[model samples]
Target: MLQAHEADIFRPDVTVLAPQEAVPARRERFATRLSPQDLERRAWKRRVNTIHVNTDVVVKAVARFDQMLADLADDVEGQCLVVPAPSGAGKSHLLARLQMRPSLVPFRDEVGPVRPLVFIKAPSPCTLKTLGLALYVALTDLELSATLKEHDIWRRVRHQMHAQLVSVVMVDEFHHALRGRTGDERRALVETLKNLVIPDPNDPLRPPGAEMRPISLVLSGMPWLRRVLKEDFQLLRRCIFMPIRPLGHSAACVKKATKFLELIEPRLGFPAPSGLSEHDMVQRMLKASAGYTGRMMHLVKKAAFRAIRSGAPSISQLDHLAFVFDEIFELGPHRNPFRVPDISTCPKLKEIEFDKLTRLMGTAQADIDPDDA
Candidate 1:
């Protein structure tokens, strides 16, 4: 080999190497604190990172609902989709996920961004005026200073929706319209919604060169929403009901739980002292969650935080999760599924029935109302 030049050998721009490699950035974990606000924010943010266990039922339901939405986009006469479920059954989560689909992507023209899907929550004690105001704020991102008449608000709502080319309007907690309202009021509310979907013959909102297509409605609420819809046959006829049931103790449920545990284990930032995928463990988890996916996530998050705070390198089923149920959720000793020996035969598991209506209405309808409101 030729001898290197003196200038090159003694170059001042030589890069120095360290003996140890640089550490990679780690995912931010929840701070070990008791602040309610911090915990709530962390919990909400963690929702995005949590594993979404899609059982067959969820897949089929999503496919069917998506197909309906696609059909509505191309049709002149818009239809309605009613998603009814119990509390903590992941209805909001499902709708949120659905809103992210490419189908809901905003359309752009020479003017600016035109959002196709308008998602709004029905205000508490929802009336036609409140509902219209909610939609107005969601569409225009502005509040009304002057109190406008219900008719004026609705007219503006329709015009804005048409101008913006909104294809679907998903209203969450739609059952609020029925809550603490008279029968006539409920009927009037339903009529207002109907009018929005299909404008009156002499509607003033049909401006020159305005798109005449109807805007589809996607309403999600508790099971009582079905009962509310039953009051108006016309409204019920326009809707396609899609029921979201809670996860029960079945082979499919077990499989989903196992898959979820497997996916989440790595992301938990700590190892599990025992296998979380075992049959008994899965059953116990189901019981603890009361067969609800949202509750299951809540339990898991609480347990994970407990493990992190205790300076544990791994989560222990006996030490961490058992204590979490007993302390955090305040389950009685006899009713604590995690602490119990036989989860399959646990009395609390038996109490976790699919019929949430029983709690709401006191008795199950022998024949569910045909209107299914």
Candidate 2:
């Protein structure tokens, strides 16, 4: 179900190593045993990669995606499931989990190859031609010419999708389709997308009056994807919008936040576990992370590493988080959410230079702040 794109794409099939002790070999017959701190440095790297805390929102998203695919199987009346969320809401991670489901894996039965689902990340500077090519490559092993016309490319893409028995086509980072475009361009893109969900009998792409097989679409991206649907009345009518809500300062949200903290605490290498699930720590974490799940996990990962580097027994205090926040986010103590006396007065991350933050973190800006202008 998961397809790899050339740029700004996360492969679902990538491996995550398990945590283990490290022993370096010295001279012959001599093996240097690593200290706990030395081993933990390497162990935490592997442990963090293995972490995936599935909260209720993630569960519901996956359930909705599954139901969409199921409905496609029965009726083939292509439906659109629009997942609109911020960059760090774990939209890509949701697609990664869906692709891992065994039932959806491409297989062959009495018929030819059956690809239940196909996933592709929408290309940067997206165009009808590039989108068609991306989908074409995922559905078949055949190569496409770089100079191919858009109509020819989509003709092949449609053929391949139908031939492969594709029930659902998931496009992550769907917001890219509308970025930095004119009114005419945006309308053109939206019209092309509408045909994917509900083909027009009169459309020249298909033979005249020919019946077309319907394939459900799963489009996940920033909140702007809703704008694409709004471009057409019919497209909006067929879409099921699912927005990922940020953590709020409510009792129920605090409980969910506590569960997430407890889930991750064990994986962070420390002499003893921190009381990350405590009400006070949970409140601070909510403020520090700006209520985004990905940001919360990233903050904790760096805080744990900071504790390790400083020889702290555990990241058990707000000071560690406060320092980590200032260091990584390039914020002073006043602007650092963890350090601010009044959480309400904490500076929003939007006010900061997102590109510089991504540079400081040594991560791709697209991976962390895809929605940022």
TM-scores, each model vs. reference: 0.74, 0.76
Top model number, TM-score: 2
- For all candidates in order, the CA lDDT equals 0.70, 0.73
lDDT of 1 by residue, 1-373 (tens): 4368877787779864453432221212433545886665466446524656675556766787688677765765667888887655666667776787797888789986688899987887778778889999999999864489877887788778777888789998787777677888788778767655665566565655675677778898767787677777876888888777666777887788787777666667664444666778878888776676656665676677776666566767767788876775455767778877777666653322333422232322222233442
How well does candidate 1 score on lDDT at residue 128? Answer: 75
Q: What residue runs in model 1 are displaced by over 4 Å at the alpha carbon?
A: 1-50, 204-209, 267-269, 318-320, 323-328, 349-373
After superposing all C-alphas onto the true structure, candidate 1 shows an RMSD in angstroms of 15.4
| Residue 40 C-alpha lDDT in model 2 | 68
Task: Write model 2 residue lDDT over 1-373, tens digit each, in one string.
Answer: 4554643366457654344322222243475678887896767667765678887777887788778776765663578888887655567777787677776888887878889889988887667777888888888866699699988888787777767777778898887777666667767777777776787777667643446767778888777678767887777788998787788888988888988999998877677778888877788778766576766777787777777767778884665788777777666878777777776777666613444543444423333334444
- TM-score of model 1 (CA atoms): 0.74
TM-score, structure 2 vs. true: 0.76
